[model samples]
Target: MDLSSQNRRQVLQTLGIATGAALLSNTVSAKNAVLKAGPAFKYALNMSTIRGHRLGFIKELEVAAKAGFTSVEIWIDIFQTYLKNGGTTAEAKKIINGLGLTIENAIGFAKWIADDDTTRKAALKQLQTEMDQLAQIDCHRVAAPPFGATGLPLLNLDILADRYHAILKMGEQSGVIPMVEMWGGSENLKTISQVLYVAAASGNKNALVLLDSFHIYKGGSSVESLALVNKNAIKVFHVNDYPAGISPQKISEPDRIYTGDGVTPLKQILQLIKNPDQPVVLSLEVFNESYYKQDALTVAKTGLAKMKAVTAGI
Candidate 1:
């Protein structure tokens, strides 16, 4: 073959290789990029830890925003303070959106399931009102105990599921989801089996199950149970650790610690439920009083870093 013809063939081959390499780079970036837990399922420190000391809602929000959490969980009381302080729901929305953080879920402590008809109806109405605020603030989930007075006896679950469904139906209409938290030391859905039973019985499309590592560990749940849970039904995980001395029989909720500070198998739990299709927000829901005394911003950043490292091995 002539030298010019050979050179032309070589140039064409190099151009084709370059084009393929560019497409592969784009594909990797778009789809299979090591899926860093990113802000998607990244840590969100619950503002409740600093509640009493921080008193004002906006002040606490400032702490979290400055801490760089990119997401957070605000309890009902904090949100009420925001509204009362002339912070309109729209204003709260703006504050969060401007900081590029999302509200993972609102902790509205209401007992939607009760033995009495009156209390139950009242709770549902109250939940609807709360949902209205949650809707305004761009939150999609509300966390609550399984339908009784705060930390009290659960209503007949058979009876409770129907009532819970009413709340779920309300959520469906309003575009919010009721994520029932696994309370650490409660007769109502204390174990994974019980939580599953209640969720299955609800039969509502909007029913969401919230997982908290501290609560799950305190409740004496097995790691294998994590594998069995319906990943789709899980909206978020409150990552924290419980001390070993706490009795499952006791009413005391364990003073939760940071992710790696305790024995919770956070990585194993992650591997069990690492469904790429499902989006999960890992929230730092530590109820520890000690951490509250430290700078809330430092606590938030530290908690996120600990979780990031824990999930790295998985």
Candidate 2:
């Protein structure tokens, strides 16, 4: 029990404590660094999966938020219904913000590519209104599908490009970007090549094309074509699957199924989209009528689960 022996023991104890602290700090720092790198893609709900459930616009937001989804794509009709119920755009934005959800895009049908001048004018007017409404809620993206010409003959690609450029300019003026959506059943712009012609011919670098797995297959276009476009050209991608046994021509939007439930090569498609600058948002957009029969929360949770499963490796 000499003084020197006691001092030596105390010094050893202090050194042990110091070494442990240093190791703990280093471990935490390394773990945090890995987390900062994050995942390659973000997930979002398209709201169409629960369309049969009949939840109001606000309720839909609640369902998504409760199900752990941070992003959602809304249909324009749902927003209009909210307005009819005396809900203001500011209030809608507040509800979404309070729930910690972001509106990634809105589904809209603006026939901006119609050959008729009068029809085109009305479609442009509708676009302006929809874009303005979207801007109020701080959502700057809208889906521009060829609603009027889906069943008609395919229009000239060059003319469609001019129309796309014009609409993109209009969207720019209102701080919104109208993404040219591809419909598999549509007569025009059904293939990746056709969409590329319009998007490229638009001569606008910010031009975007909305893609869906179902539509891509329905249109008889190869899924591999997605690799040809720059990743930046696609802002939002709709994720869904269809039964392998069904012919692509026979499948409709209602036949859409949850991701990974069918035979769609989603993993391969994800590999094709190589954008290092930013993570692309994968929105689940299924119109399966059967999903509507389930409770809204269950449907949302189920959809989110399937989405996570398909993108787990990516």
Give candidate 1's total backbone clashes. Answer: 1
- The number of the candidate with the highest TM-score is 2
Which residue pairs does candidate 2 place in steric collision? none
lDDT of 2 by residue, 229-273 (tens): 889988799999988788977888899999999999899888787
Q: Any idea what lDDT model 2 has?
A: 0.89
Q: Give the TM-score (vs. native) of candidate 1.
A: 0.83
TM-score of each: 0.83, 0.88
The list of candidate 1 runs beyond 4 A from truth reads 1-40, 147-155
Instruction: Report lDDT per candidate.
Output: 0.75, 0.89
lDDT of 1 by residue, 167-274 (tens): 888898777888767765666767676676677788886677887776676677887888888888877877776665666566254367877887677778877766
What's the alpha carbon RMSD for model 1? 5.4
